[model samples]
Target: MNNNIKRTLTTTILAAAFTVQAGENNFDQAYNSVSEADLRSHVKTLASDEFEGRQPTTIGEEKTLDYLTRQFTALGYQPGNNGSFLQPVELVRIEADPNVTLQIGDDSFEYKQNMVIGTSREQESVSLKDSELVFVGYGVNAPEYGWNDYAGVDVKGKTAVILVNDPGFANPDSGKFQGKTMTYYGRWTYKYEEASRQGAAGALIIHETAPASYGWSVVANSWSGPQYHLVTANGNKDRVAVEGWLSVEAAQTVFQKAGLDFEKLKEQAKNGPTAKAMSVKASVTVKSSLKRSKSNNFIATLPGSKAPDEHIIYTGHWDHLGKDPSKKGDNIYNGAHDNATGTASLISMAKAFASLKQRPARSVSFLIVTAEEQGLLGSKYYAEHPVYPLNKTVANLNLDAMNILGRTKDVAVVGFGKSELETYLTKAAKRQGRIITQEDRPEAGYYYRSDHFSFAKKGVPALYAEGGAESADEESAKYRKKMKVILNGCYHQVCDEYRDSWDFGGIIEDTQMFFEVGYDLANSDDWPKWNKTSEFQRPE
Candidate 1:
């Protein structure tokens, strides 16, 4: 063997020997190191008024990254990005003129009222004038599931009006499309991506509060702010020229104008093979102005002893809505649950790993990203421009809006059956005298709403687990009702600040659970893979 090959082989052998020598699992010590006090301290700082809501491309980002880097350094972690803790992500922010309106034949859709639209493409100017519109049902084309909403339609150079969520959602059938649970196909991101793949000039997802989960106000607020997209080499030429959402009422108006029954078509769309494409006899117009900026993805590494080349990643987005100046009173969206809690968990997890007596066989990385509130952009960038080969990545465990509802009898694994990581989570939770359950409200599409998805799309097994229904000491019904109130009242609003009433016990439990899962993956020879039937499974 050549000198370099000999050196690599010797190192691997030596590391394996070291792993064998370290018989006792030091994970308990590490898990114990993940303390509630530490987690709360970190979250308090991250979500404080001083951090200015941790928004990307602002002083808030600077403060957040500095805090993360400092904490990782204190935990004895090395810079993950080639000796640098920060990964530079180029992005373009587009602020659409609020006055922009969409004319669908005689029916007009007003911005932020009837509809919301923006383009992912990075251009000085973008416009679509009198583009032909086609109702393409769910807009999904999943061959594995034997479903295709755009099968008979040619949507190229025209606008495709699609429905949010999967067809199985509105009308459930166990025989088709994962039943009521939202698949990756149900995500709004998928709708846009599938539209782009079909060569559509534009895509508009018709939003219903039930199917879409969140209220119309969510779509309005999320899409209204400065929209962000990764800076593309071809200036996002691959993406649709226009991408957006239309209110249910507005969508019904378009269908009525086209001499079609919106309700009847929706039912048809849910039934397999009955869904057909129809010309809406309508058109749309949109224009946007672009702004460009740079964001940083803070990456820190705890190198392994045996297989340093392989990795188990812990990821969380650090960005939120920032400060809205228009609001008269408190305008800072602290995002204490939306993700400050999740971001802080990264530090606690890092501390736990660093406290270990012996490092795991594989490395662990803390990927604290930005622009999650702006459509998971930072994680998307990291997935595209990874510091390590994606094939070498064993798994990603993501935390978002951590459990503030106290300890629970079970942990909910979002996208539960997608990977073997869920099995590992179940084992860990079982040790804590807790069971594992799939997300109760699968219709919300929680799996696709977080950062782990960015890695999952690239074939890395990712875990997104949370405290499930039935808090240990509270009645399940009362617990769920209160949780719903929080989700409705505080989520993405200025009110998502750190509160004294919030329980960190469940957060602590879940954080340690994540630590244990990562520890198992990093040390074991087993490489977790997506389920055989999973769309995210690696091509063999």
Candidate 2:
């Protein structure tokens, strides 16, 4: 065998041996340290009315940081960020005026109803006046996929109207673009990014329920409020002046006004690039109020006994939607299931690791980030300016929106089959009498929507798993139906409050399994690898 191959084999064997030895050691005490009662208490406090929904740059952020700091200090964890628990993330908040209307030729679309628009640029006003409209199918420029929507078009000073989701979404069985599984290219974030790269002055995505995954309510609620992005030296001038979404109805009206058939174009888009210029021109002006502030990413670490430089990271976002005074009855978002549960899980996990009889060979870090509701701003900033060198970072295990339903016979691994971390998770789950399963909805792009994605983009292995669809008890079908209702109704709404009747059985099981996986990685020299089929690869 070649020297490199032989060395790799030896390392793998040694790591496996270390894992087996570590598995044999007694971890019952540490494993049992995570209690349902403790988790409930943390979630209750964080999601309470006094917390004001835990929005960053508000009073809510201050309270959340203080609470997390105390919990970590009590658990005997040292600050992971250079003797300080807080890593300052500079952010720019922009709230667009509500009265703005998007004009497409003679049709005018109102904000939050027919359309919603905003800008990432750090300015008071951004305007696109009488710019030509170009239909750039999927707005994708993937060379590997042999697709370039703007191949021969000059959208430099025009507005690019794009479609939501990827090409494979419409025909999952056609063997195109991962087949029903949404890729990074399918995300709305990518659509805006690609448009900016094409030098488009504005980008507007047509939203369809099936393709976009969520309903128009989700889009309206999320985009209407204040927007936040990491502060940049150039004020994000490279980005399009305006980024927005159009309801399916509004898109059709605009297309008809331009003497085109929207449905036919959508079909042509599915096959390949359909970059066509429309006869209509686009005009919109966004006047925004800007606020510059600093949010904190709270980090605490348990030092490794052997290799302190190597790290295993646990991440959870602490920020939520914050209170909206414009509403009458309930103003607070109280994101209990959305993320309070995940934030609390970080504390529970930290407690479990602290109770260990012997420290693991590698370090474990708990990172509670801010501004997740505002498009993962906190995590994105951390990824770009990492507290620890990305190379030394072992893996990122993210906790978000934990299951409040009863225990399940299986665990749902989001973005499954992407990494070898699943091997470790599967082994740990089997011991708990549970199996690992793929996420029920792969087209939602859940993997790219969380904090773990930040680490994943940097080529570090990441895992995002939660309670599964199959219940442990006899009422499996009934349990699944109930979960569906809750997930669909409460997501990003004021109704997502903490409930007294929530069952913590599933969360406990999932949390315990997470502990086992992280414990194994911490005690071994194993470097989990991404699957060859995965689009991400570790940088050489």
Q: How far is candidate 2 from the true structure (C-alpha RMSD, Å)?
A: 3.2
Task: State the local distance difference test value for candidate 2.
Answer: 0.89
Summarize candidate 2's per-residue lDDT along 219-332 as a digit string, tens digits.
998988788898999999999999999999999999999999999999999998889999899998999999999999999999999999999999999999998888899999
Model 2 residue runs over 4 Å out of place are 1-26, 475-480
Candidate 1 RMSD computed on C-alpha atoms after optimal superposition onto the true structure: 6.3
Q: Report how far residue 289 has shifted in candidate 2, in Å.
A: 0.3
Where model 1 places Cα greater than 4 Å from the true spot, the runs are 1-26, 273-285, 475-487
Q: Write down the lDDT of every candidate, Cα atoms only.
A: 0.83, 0.89
Give the local distance difference test score of model 1.
Answer: 0.83
Clashes of each: 0, 0
